[model samples]
Target: MEIKEVKQRKEIIEPLLEVWQKSVRSTHHFLNEKEIVMISQYVPSAFENIPHFIVGYDEQKPIAFMGIDGERIEMLFIDPICQGQGIEKN
Candidate 1:
């Protein structure tokens, strides 16, 4: 496992979006299906505005990612299959 800063937004946007949807669906059960769909549409553009983004990988596959804005963490998501593996804790 390794953690690294993301230098290119386009490179992992799709996978990160998948991770985001999965993570949100599993955790944010309060959101309706329509709400999820609505939010999904904006994820790409919102990600582009994140000032600092990083990803965690196992081998060559991305397992988790985080977006930070100064001292605040805007987003942190882990692939559903990769959850509870302490990827976020590290």
Candidate 2:
């Protein structure tokens, strides 16, 4: 996998949104389908304004990503299919 820093939100947001949704479904049991859908509506704005964003690509497409604000990690998601492969463990 190749890790990349994203300079344009548009270049990464759509693919990473799919990653975020699947990752949330795999682990965020507190959220129902309706809540998840509702929350996703704000994702684009957040991604666009986040201080930093990066993605992990597996040869062809983005499979994982993280959003950072200053020193804090604001968002992190890994495609459920790629979870546990330690794609971001380092």
Candidate 3:
């Protein structure tokens, strides 16, 4: 797998959203659509001219993603279809 850092939301946010929804589906009784909308809305403003996203892909298809905020890991999600493959272990 090739790990890449993507800075543009237009390029990365959709995949992030896909994983985010799947991860939260079972636990959240009612998914907050507005929260996701807010995230998409504020991502551009939240960017700090640094690498905030790490995407792991098998060739061209993304398998896992992580959101890094400085030294803190803010979000991590591995595609449900590809879990248990150590994709998110890193």
How much is 75 displaced in model 3, in angstroms? 0.5
Write down the worst ten-residue block by lDDT for model 2. 7-16
- Decoy 1 TM-score against native: 0.91
lDDT of 3 at 57: 80
| lDDT winner, 1 or 3 | 1
Residue 27, candidate 3: C-alpha displacement in angstroms: 6.1
User: Cα RMSDs of all predictions?
Assistant: 1.1, 1.1, 3.5
Q: List, in order, the clash count of every candidate structure.
A: 0, 0, 0
The Cα error of candidate 2 at residue 8, in Å, is 0.6
Residue 11, candidate 1: Cα error in Å is 2.1
- Return the TM-score for candidate 3, rounded to 2 decimals: 0.63
Clashing pairs in 2: none
Off by over 4 Å in 1: none
Provide the lowest-lDDT 10-residue window in model 1: 7-16
Candidate 1 clashing pairs, residues 3+ apart or interchain: none
The digit string of per-residue lDDT tens for model 2 on 12-49 reads: 67787898899999999999999999999999898888
Winning candidate number (TM-score): 2
lDDT of 1 at 10: 84
Instruction: Identify the superior model by TM-score, candidate 1 or candidate 2.
Output: 2
